[model samples]
Target chain A: MSTQIEQQETETEADEETEPEVESPGERRRAQRDERQAIEEAQRETEEASLDDENTITLKVFRYDPEVEGKQEPRFDDFRVPFHKGMTVLDALIYARDHYDSSLTFRHSCRQAVCGSDALFVNGKQRLGCKTQMSELDDPVRIEPLPHQEVVKDLVVDMEHFYDQMEAVEPYFDADETPDDKLEEQRQTRENREKVKMSTRCIWCGACMSSCNIAAGDNEYLGPAAINKAYRFAMDEREGENRKQERLRIIEQEHGVWRCQTQFSCTEVCPKDIPLTEHIQELKREAVKNNLKFW
Target chain B: MAQHYSSFDRGGRRWLFQRLTAVFLIGVLAFHFMLLHFVNHAADLTFLGTQARMSQVSYFATMWLFLVTATFHGVNGVYNALVNQGLTGSRKNAVKYLLGIAGLLLVVQGTRVSLAMTTLV
Candidate 1:
């Protein structure tokens, strides 16, 4: 495969140790690996030495790789990154990867908070890595993948479960009826739009779900983000009353809004400042009111 | 999804009842504590003194309601906590019935004790 060739190329170029023509291919490969190990040891020493320097910031990053023999066990790798005025946590991670170790892996895009690809556990809090500044954190910023999710590799977690929960809520808006004319428009009042405004801003970053205690324990719980997603559609007046009732039914299931303890953990960690707990409470009230009407 | 049509299966009723009972208990619990501990000194109270208080129709009803609400709130809270801790399958059903029976017995025995204290029964 082409990937095999690329792997070989990187392996050979990893270290600049002079190779003698007399050695076998196996021997050359071993020598190259040894040189790479020696480089890692030297880098770690420099990483330790820079801790005393005033200009550099220490980053304790969680590292793991199931496929790599030595890295199979989870551990924290320290990187010494030069501090800058407006440098964010993502910038520091990028600098560490580019300058010190190319294998330091993390997901990042857009360099802004909109992409929602860089949610990380920074300093014992869930935060957007690109939005969190290094100056605001303590000396050694501890960065790890979000908790309550299986880590796929270094700084990347399995988001499949989060996606599954989101899907279970039937997040798409479904109107009960549409106008006969194709050109006709479905309009929403300013009040209705304003009501669901904050709930619509969710970026599916998984930070709220990761921060939720109920979602962590009850695996079947729909979670804050998914419930908020339901809130957005369920509150929209454009979706007819029939659809709203249907949406309410979905969220009112045994593991739905009832599982929420109103801890506000999701609201506190939301990057978009969505009032998650308040929305969940409102849904609970709505479900009860609907039931009372039937009774 | 067809099963979700009924309001009872949605869990909203119990959730609402829990909050309602919590509000009621908050007020009643303070009164119970104050009456027993502050207003009527526990050391000075005897069996006849308690019977005299329980013999009053209004007092008997209040105490009975207090006992029933406390038992429901305490047992329901415990069940919710265990459910939230990922209890499921047959174990969840076992806990549900166990708590239900325990709550029922508590209410029954509490009524009998309250009736024994009252001269009206």
Candidate 2:
């Protein structure tokens, strides 16, 4: 009885293997033709759907180059790019660069908003190109380098001054003590981490700095980004109270947190959604509190 | 690298003063406008009526304080705006002194005007 059952199972397996070869050549051809026709129909539907005028977007890109003869006089170049769902400003710019003109210049990397390289003045506001969705912007979207920074060349601003201000803040952790055990790491409370977490999100994209009217006016003003950087470390529990005092002193200068007018533009334009004015305001309070202790 | 611990570097005082003065001005200015425009009416204001209001010690004191605060706020605002525009060195110093003189003149003249009003009433 077991031999009979095994033989029946083997026969079924052989039938499955020979099933494909059993089909006639004419039937196989007809099946292949049906498959090709279905694929073509899908392709046709997609093409027809994308044929609408609304599916294209126009971009007015700022063009300038002191070295290049033609672009020496600043001008705007119009680029018409096909619109797709979930497309970003960075995608449109990349398409324009590749298909329209190879000489079009801009800085971008990691395309994921972490590198902070592609902050641009879009429609008169500071925005991250990669993070901003094209569908949200008006047609003929205007793209330009950040205002108040020296334009290096088309869509690229000289970031040296911004870097200098960021460096001036000493954007690093400096704790006075370490654990006795060599393997132990500094422990921070959940509340402390939560406090500084928003400030720590800053990617140094310079968007907040560019949006700030105070930063644009006062060259020496530490700017929102730097102050926020100071806030991240100053508010950390592991940094010790002494280090916090030192940080406060650095940010309480004439051109430091004092220069902020609570304009709220920095907070509004922050790509990371950091409450910059709040941070600066907090630092101001801390400085005053620290100063009053002398009395 | 050398840390300067000068008291003059304290911008917190000025920022606090700006906010404090703003709050005070909002109340006093509103009262002033209401008194002159709504309660008393500006068209019917006479020298005697003006004097009648100014002669009160509290009113006189408030007006004097208003004059001082307004001058400071205005001049300081202009100075800050200029500094934000990258004013530096001798130019900044020159603007500072000029604004200081202007503020002093405004306050002195304002006091004189108030005193004359009181005497006339």
DockQ of each model against the real complex? 0.29, 0.34
Give the per-residue lDDT digits (tens) of candidate 1, residues A147-241.
99999899999999898888877888778988898679888899999999999889889999999888888887889999999999999988999
What is the Cα-based TM-score of model 2? 0.81
TM-score of chain B of each: 0.90, 0.88
Superposition error at A152 for model 1 (Å): 0.9
lDDT (Cα) of model 1: 0.88
Candidate 2: C-alpha RMSD to true structure equals: 10.2
Fnat per candidate, as a fraction, reads 0.54, 0.50
**CAPRI-style class, candidate 1:** acceptable
Candidate 1, superposed: residue stretches over 4 Å from native: A1-52, B1-8
Write candidate 1's Cα lDDT for B1-121 as tens digits.
2222234257787788888889989998999889989999988888898899999999898889889888988998899898788887799999999999999999999999998888978
Candidate lDDT values, in order: 0.88, 0.86
